[model samples]
Target: MTDEPNEIDGDLYEHHHIVVDAGQDLLRIDKFLMDRLPNVTRNKVQAGIKDGFVKVNGAEVKPNYKVHPMDEISVMLPEPPRDEELVPEDIPLDIVLEDDHLLIVNKPAGMVVHPAYQNWSGTLVNALAFHFQNLPEMKGNDGRPGLVHRIDKDTSGLLVIAKTERAMNGLAKQFFDHSIERTYYALVWGVPEEPSGTVYVNVGRSLKDRRVTMAFPDGDFGKHAVTHFELIEDLRYVSLLKCNLETGRTHQIRAHMRWIGHPLFNDTTYGGSEIVKGTVFTKYKQFVQNCFKMMPRQALHAKTLGFIHPVTKKKIFADSELPEDFSSVLEKWRHYIDHTD
Candidate 1:
């Protein structure tokens, strides 16, 4: 990955272009893209086609138009809106590494990375704003203090905060170039077929539920996302997995793993809280429920992160230990699987 800008900007939208592979067969443009674009929907694509946001060979086409090999395609998608004001609060921060240019924080689960809507306080951004009163602001940031990226509120992990505009822009370019390395540890519902493999798919918000993300394996609709995962331990019904992200889309690992039929353990949104693999005996069910009570959130942790230091021109890596809730649940599963078998 190189440090070049990824998006081609228009007046109000971003442009995407693709050329049909030489060996590609005749397929509906909507169908072809439904399986390709990340976090997109068929309806969204069809709407784009109707509104002339999508074009084939420099001409706008309908949703049912057949795409042939070597066809040039382009689409214009609206840019994300600017964020709202950021209010500084006195939330505590678990500072891992801090210097003049940037700081890496070990964020705990259940803390929102930034303040939004009803989450107007107690966020990591609020903490940063309180601590760094004179932090530089990025363009179109509204009032976001020093954020270059974010993690899910329920996913605990390491996050890098930039203190200067040069650092922020440089780090953003690195992410756009896909040069950042992030690894996560997850307790999943079932063991993967292979000890290690990659889930290459498109990820997008579900049409049915906009709150959660979905994966498209047949190239339906979504942003491109890839997760390379390795099995660490098998606990009969569930397993431990280390997932490495190639593209950091929203809910990439969670949606990709769910697409592969192995949702993270205790992840209620993806059907991991239920007994997915164990027997139907009453004792087994009770044991599973007990495990859920022990760790109420999805069993995931951003264990490691690596990136190029913007100031030093050197590589920097940060690793975090699993929180008590996640590790304790793993121990319980190990004990239950061992004793019951």
Candidate 2:
């Protein structure tokens, strides 16, 4: 509701101290500050915590430190001359479904879900902000509003966005309860050993590599994730698979598939090499290279989403078509299958 800039930047430094109230007890230090200081980033807050700029009870604490009621909280804020924040771009959107409470969009590849370091502009949130003009504010940070779920930056697909606080709360609850259905179409390097199967794995932050997520077992730092996949079509070397998300986690589909030894084609982040020599895809190597050259991201897309409407209580379903680059790759795969098989 407030048009406050989500981030502040510059050289003005100021130190402030405040007493925590009873209602704020057990709140994470960074999260509490993120709520109070609308313009500061979570990274900045964590940095301050690490540099001992944030203190509790006169002692320096980590960002995840929980604050109790009546504790004294102190922070040193650097006032950066604020630049124009997150200017909305005139990016065209594909609205698959829209109602007073929610909007389902076919998000194209190459668009970031929200703003972050080095990506403060040209995000889907910025475009929504510009187009909607009066989106309801979420309870969390000021950066993103009404964002109930997210899709990967390079993975194009259907994304459901809430328009009202009630709707947001309800939709978030549904997702947390695993009541919503999300299906994706992915083109991978090979067919699985089984025709259909479930990948039950724990996905957690990779301690060695922050950019990549890994699937591990119980008691690890990762959360439990389940993906049900069925083989839709096989192209000898590559296969088309339909994936259903039972529990959504960061890179759930990609990481789960990679963990099961079926890394997506051309997904370099998860150990997939480009179509090279000596594989069944030798004949279409040039075509694959051209498609990868033109495609900005991966060949994954959220194809369908189904949920009960928060207000209407009616079952709703939305679907998105594959982008042109993915379609072209599938076309080549079909051609290869026809000739070879």
Candidate 3:
């Protein structure tokens, strides 16, 4: 409904001190903040907690900390400079579906979802700010307009935007409930052992590198994540997969796929950039390299999204075609297998 909260750079962004209700039940502080913070995502709140920016009753608390009755919660974060504020840019958008209440856009790969510390311009948020005026503002959202969720910068997909606060609430609830239907097409290395199966793991920020997420199979840390994968095509050394997310944690599909020994194709972050399968011959390596050049980023696409309309109270479903790089690369694989075999 409103703009996304500003990035935490240096200046004080926000300072909130709230006293828990006497009847408050034991709820994770992260979840507590989700309901209290204006336009802030769970990941942001978790980051604050992880970075010691969040405290309970004057004591630093982890994300999983429980908020008890009469407890005091404080969150103070550094704000980006005034110049760091969002700047609308004139960027082309592939809008898939649009209505008075909401719209679904097919986001191309290589576009950041919103402005952050380094990427302050040329983001989807900036485009929305430019093309529309007076998008419903959610008090202290900082400024993403109506965006609620986001995909990775290099992962192309269908994303929904709300036009009103009512729509925002409705959509947010659907996401929280895992009732939103989202399916992704991921080109991964290695055919899975099973033609189709589900991967259940706990995914969280790597204690080693906070920027990237990883899987914690022990379930002691991180959030519960589930990704149901069905093998769609087998390309010998590689495979095409249809991944249905049961819980949408950060990089859930990527993390799960990597942990399951099938990292996405061309996903340098998760180690798929190398020739995970196929011969170690120079020519085979060159072929994989050529494929990587064909699709420079992770070979993943958000193919479908379905949810209940916020205002219309009806089911809305939309599907997106694979982008050029994805389709072309897949075609190349098809051709390679057809001829090389």
> Residues 125-205, candidate 3, lDDT per residue (tens digit)?
899988876666544455678887889999999999988889888888899899999999999999999999999899997
Evaluate model 3: give its TM-score: 0.78
Least well predicted 10-residue stretch by lDDT in candidate 2: 1-10
User: By the TM-score metric, which is better: model 1 or model 3?
Assistant: 3
Estimate, for each residue in 1-341, the C-alpha lDDT of model 2 and write its tens digit. 22223232244243556678878658888878775654566787899899876778768898889889888876655553245366777877789999899999998888889987667888999889877866666666455876888988889999998888878888888998999999999988788889899999999767555457898966466888999999999877778899999999989898998888788777878865566322555556766676567564667899999999998989999977888988887887788678764
In model 3, how large is the Cα lDDT of residue 182?
A: 95
- Stretches of candidate 2 above 4 Å error? 1-86, 276-287
lDDT of each: 0.84, 0.79, 0.86
Alpha-carbon RMSD, each predicted model: 8.5, 5.2, 6.1
lDDT of 1: 0.84
For candidate 2, the per-residue lDDT at 274 reads 64
Q: Which of candidates 1 and 2 is the stronger one according to TM-score?
A: 2
Structure candidate 3, residue pairs in collision: 2-138, 3-143, 3-144, 3-145, 4-143, 4-144, 11-79
